[model samples]
Each structure stands twice: as C-alpha cells, then as structure tokens.
Target: MPSQPPDSSKPKPRYTLDEGAPGAFEGETVTRRKFMTGGAMAIGGVATAAFGLPALGFALGPQFEDGTPDRWQDMGPEGEFSVSTYVPKVMNLVADAGEAGKHTVYIRKFDPKRDSKRNADLPYVAISNRCAHLGCPVRYIQASKRFVCPCHGGVYEFEGKVAGGPPVRPLDRFYTRVRGGRVEVGERFSLNSELRRFSVRDPSNHLDGPWQYLYPSRPST
Candidate 1:
C-alpha cells in the first residue's frame, strides 16, 4: 500500500479547547492546573540554580585558579648541580605552609650534547618530582635512569617523557637562570613529548595535540 502525504493546508490545533480537551476553556492552550504546575517548576529550577551553581563553582573553581608565583627561587650554587645526574632539592611550593609546602625538585646542568637543541640556551634543567599521572612523588632511579611513580606504574625517561603506564604528559619543568653566581629556578612549565614548552598544567592533563586545547593554560602558567 502507498503512504499518504501529510496535509499542509490543514491548520494545527492551537488551543486545548479546539482539540476538545476536558476542563479546557476558550483561548486556552493548556489547562490552568498544567500551566500553574509548569510555571512553578520553572521558578523552582531557577531558584535551585541560583544557590546551587555558585556553590558548585566555588568547589571546583580552584582547579582553574592561577596562584603560582612569578618570582624566581634560588636553588643553589651552579657547582651543586651537574650535567650527568639529577640532584634532588627541596623547595617551597606553597608560601607560608612551612614543611608541608616543601616539594622536591630535581636539578641538573644543561648538557647541549645530550639535551634538546631547542633548549640549548637554558642554563640548567630543573624538573618537578611530581608524577604526571596522579600527584604522587616520583623518584629518579639511577640504575634505570628513569622517574618511577610509586602510586602507579607511570614511568618517564631521563628527559621526563612518558615511557610507560597512564601518564598523560611529561613531567613538568622550571625555567632556570644564573643570577649572582647562584642557579635560580623560575616559573614552572609543562612539556610535550617533543620537549616543547607549554603553560603549567595539573597532573593527568594532556599537553599534546588537540588534547592541549581541552586543558587550556591558566595565567599563572
């Protein structure tokens, strides 16, 4: 059997009354009870959002917050660090938190022969000990010459590039400069697999390709 086409010339029923609905009156598109219920629901949703949205934002807003300092931190004399191996040093990440704010940073002299040519101008390589997977502390294993996260199996090569497990990107790095004969570590930044520098991102945030767009860099980065 052939299907019939819809009638475009016929006018649509604009009111419940026109559709012969029970408890409907002239010029009524909906019953009074339904209209009241819909209006009440709309008002309730707006009221809920007014209170809920702000609380939700307050809870999650810190993830996007930018509070990193611009001032450079003194690591030590340039002789303390070498080009071959990473030397771990403790530094304050959060201000005024005492011992709790201290974090471990690995520093080494920049070797132009072994490191990326793009970073040849850098005075030293300062890497954050935080794993890219979870915020777990990673220790540099001299035997394997790799950074291993104890919380997970996330592993990074000597250059901090992810070599295995669930890490999204490489370990973070800090800008280094020589001032007053001491090595000073500047702003913390992130890196891609190719060793390209990017704004600092949280653990598990990807900084390669389109994924980098999702975790947009904050101002503090």
Candidate 2:
C-alpha cells in the first residue's frame, strides 16, 4: 500500500455561540437550552426529595423511635364488672381532648373457666369497640353474645376473637389493672389469630402468617 499525506480538520467549537447554537450568548460554553434543562432537573430532584423524604419518614420513622406509653386510665370501680358478661363503659382515650376523647370500651371480669390461659393474668378483659377491620364502632349484642360491626358486618366472639367477615386478627385489647378500688386500662395491644398479644397496630394490619414478615411492627406501635 502507498502512504498518503496527513490531512487537517477543524475541531468542534468550545463555545456555544462559536458553534452557532440557537439563543447562545457570546462566549457561552453551554447553550441556554442545556442550562435550563439542567436547572429544571435539579429543581425537580429537590422538589421530589422534599415531598418524598417526609412521607418516607412518616412511614419508617416509627420503627426507630423509642418509648412506649405506660399511661393508665381509670374507667370505674371494680365492683361494676362481672365475669359473665361485658359491660359498656365510656373511656377517655385521647388525652386532654375532654368529651371528644370518649370512646366506648367493653370490659368484663377475667374468667378462668372459659377465657384462654394466655390472657388470664389480666384482672379485667377490656376490649376496644373499634372494629379490627376498619375501625367502625361495634356494638355488642347481648342476645347473640357477639360484637357486630354495623358498617362492614365484621363479627367477633365474646372473647374478641374474629368470628367472621374481613377482620385480619382478633379485636384489639388493653392491659387491665386494679388501681386502688377502681379498674384501670393500660396501653393497647393487638393479638394474633391464636390470641397471642403483640404491640398495638393500626386497623387492617395483620399479626400472623406472611403478613407479619411483610409488615413488621414498629417501635411506636
């Protein structure tokens, strides 16, 4: 093969104006369009992080936060509750909310004969009227001995275990204690299908099976 002589070629312009870029200012290295695009992207990223980080914190922060409530609320004297049946009592759940905090709680004397052994340590069985399915108020029917949700027809047995409908686990319960001569309700706790107690969870959160692994309990629970 025969050797060819070297050829000279023009290099790409360093400045946008020198390269005839549209709307490019004199001596500009980057075009206005490129600058705007980069700025827009940076702004968008910041905006996304502003919204996204809080939401992520709201979702995951509970897992790290320490301290669980040791507060107790006295509902009534010990003489009122009976081992045979549940009694409806108005309780102030939200502190400092006055009348607005009033929520109906079902309380009964713990019965060793019929009640499960796992929860017999509780002096009284205090159950929340909030439905395990969607937090609709449930009314206990004396005739049927069942708690029935009017909104979703979620039914729970006398022991607060899910009997029917969309409830994921047993109805939530609170720790009970005898303070002086009155009955007191302590921090709320959730239960598994087998009536095993766990930390309080929001409605529709399950405590058993694969759902337990998927949605583990948070520290603030």
Candidate 3:
C-alpha cells in the first residue's frame, strides 16, 4: 500500500468567546476542565450555605429578639416567713410562652427594731442559692448565720456578703416588693461593689469595683 500524506484539507479545532452572556464563565464556551471546576465550586457554595445559615441564626437570633422580661412573681403571704430566720423557697420562672425553669432562693425576714440600720421598710431579703465561686448550690448555716458552698470553701454572710474562701463576690439577691400582704420577687442582681462592705445602703452594682476583673459582668445562658 502506498503511504498517504497528512490531510491538510481537514478543518482544525476552533474556540470562540460569546458576547453578552452571564455567569463566572460568561462570554466563553467552557472546556471540560473549566466545566468540572465550576460545578465543584457551585456544589461547595450550596453546602456552605446549608451549614452556615443555621449556625449564624443560632448565634445571633437571641440578640435580635426581645430579652427576658422582669416579671414580679408572688411567692406567698409575708406571714409565711418567720422573723430573723432564713427560709428556703423554690419558684418556677415564667417565660413568654410558659414556665422557663425553677430556682432556689433563701428568704430572711428581719425585725424592724432589731436592725434599724438595715432597710426598715424592706424587712424581707431574698438571696440566690447558687454560689458565686463556681455556680454550686450553697447551704445556709443557721448556727453561724452564713452560707457555705460545698464545691469550694466559699462562704457568704446572712446578707449575701462574701465572708470567706474563693467566691469573687456575694450571692445574688432578688428584687423584692411587698403588696397586699404578699411577697413579690423580681429579677436577681449581684452584690458586686457592696460585697466588700456590710451595708444595706450600698446594694448590688454591676459596673463598680473589682467585679469587672473578678467575675463575669453578665450571667451565661
């Protein structure tokens, strides 16, 4: 057989860019390599949005919504609490929908004449049972008139002042009001500044003294 020469008459492969087109590869017909790359990129973007959208919503959703309300709950009649003694009470906190949760509080009713320095008008005091050191439940010692945390050696005075050990500040106290012979408890506030001194005149101040360094300014959810 005779050897044939290369067919120079055959049409060579051609590539051209199309005008007025849309997309990352706009204006150009993509090659197999370019098409595969673009497909992978599109899949990656969809996957990222699938996982990222929910995570973003979870982190920032609470910030945009209305915060927890400060609703005063009726504990009971004032007569239920004995004078000069700590009484433990557990109450379920109500939220926007229904019951949020329950918390334990130590309520003390003081005699008006015994401690004139203490607020005579507000004779009732309600303190949180959660310890300031590490969020442990503190036990009240009637003999010593102090709260002792078993987790650590933290101790707090009857007035919720930090008496000893590792507690950065005193136990938090509830805002209280007496109306129609009933005791109403509201939001809890920490004794940040006033924990250093034992005085009813100075109450909890979140922005004062060493509280910024010692403990978190706000409670973690």
Candidate 4:
C-alpha cells in the first residue's frame, strides 16, 4: 500500500483588474488638474443655468424698448356679426399688456348710419359694451330694443348711442370691418369724433361735456 505526500509549492495569485493598461492602478485618487477642471465645469454649468440663459433671453428676445407694449393681433372680420343682436367681445389694443388695456366691445348686426328702427336696412354695428357712465357692462334687452347697463341704469340704443340714464355719451366703438366671412375688429381706440363731440361727455359729470369720465371728481362713497 502506498500513501501520497502533500505538495504546497504554488504561490497565491495577487488580485488585479482584468484587461486594464499597465500603471492604471498606481493611485486611487484622480489628478488635481482633472478634479479642478470637473469642479469648474460643474460650477460653470450651474452659473449658466442660473443666470446666463435668462440674461441672454432678455438681451436678444423681445425687449420693451419704449415701455409701451406692441400692437395687438387683430380680431378679424365684421361680416359674421348677427343682425340686431349685441355680441360681447374683448378687443386687445396692445400685446402682452393684459385685460386692463384691452376693452370689452359689443358688436351687433346693424347698419352703421341707420337709426334704431326694428326694420333697419343694414345688419349689425359694433359698440363698446362698457357702460358710458361708470364703465359697467351693458346687456341687450330685446323687449325694450336697447342695451341696458345693470349698473346705474344706463341705456344705449342699438347704434350704441346713449338713449338715457347717467351715461353722458354713447358706448365706445371699435374699428371694425368685414373679411372672409367673418367680422374682424381692430385694436380699441377712442370713440369716433362725431360721437365723442355730441355724446355724453362724462357720466360722472354729465353736464360739463360728453367726454368726461364719471367718478373722476366725485367724492368717495
């Protein structure tokens, strides 16, 4: 019977990264220059995101040069307006200025120069829905054939000229036209010259002029 003796001649293998280039594992930390470069890149990226892009947009994009907003896009076409029915709309005079500068105008089907007869010849005319007296909204009353302002009981005819009440003048009008089967209204402006001259001057002070704004000199209620 023969017994085999134990053999322990092989040395233990050192752990190494597979397929790595020589001297790649000489140091655990990255180079200082590389670390500084990475830090600088991160800071620069943050700075660019935080401030640079917005400043660039302010410089290159649309700037408010004269503090006045741009002209608003038109609400096109006046032909689509229905006859004798007052349709409410918002007219933008300036872009991006919001609702304050814009006006609430009403367009109805009627002839421009015709008087307020039920059987008038033309179709519709546009009028400012804002009450001439206190800048209140006016509603169309078919039964009375007039636009009635719920506030202070101002009344306007179909032509938007004032019929009665605290309103000193007619409702404001828009620059309106017909185009391509639609009724288009341009940016809001002051009332037509004739209406301004003869209409109620001021709702707040009706006796003075047709153009005065009501509540301007009135005592606080």
Model 1 weakest lDDT span, ten residues long: 58-67
TM-score of each: 0.67, 0.67, 0.55, 0.47
Residue 208 error, candidate 1, Å: 0.9
Worst 10 contiguous positions by lDDT, candidate 2: 212-221
- What is the model-wide C-alpha lDDT for candidate 1? 0.84
Residue 128 miss distance in model 2 (angstroms): 0.2
Candidate 4: deviation at residue 22, Å? 99
**Model 1 stretches astray by more than 4 angstroms:** 1-69, 218-221
lDDT of each: 0.84, 0.84, 0.65, 0.54
TM-score of 3: 0.55
| lDDT (10s digit) by residue, model 4, range 1-221 | 77865445754223222224344344424445556899999999998888977655544332222322233234545654566566676776445668765766677766544544432422335566767677777887777878999978888776666688877656655555545656665433233224532222233334233223321222111
What's the lDDT for candidate 3? 0.65
CA-only RMSD, every prediction: 7.0, 6.8, 12.7, 21.3
Please give, for residues 1-221, the per-residue lDDT of candidate 1 as tens digits: 99988577988689999877898899888888888999999999999999988766644554566535477889999989888899998888776889987888999999888888766667899899989888799999989989999998999999888999999889998888899989988777888888887767888888777676567565443
Better of 3 and 4 by lDDT: 3
Better-scoring candidate (TM-score), 2 or 4: 2
Q: Candidate 2 lDDT, tens digit per residue, 16-45?
A: 988788888888999878889999999999
Count: clashes, candidate 4: 20
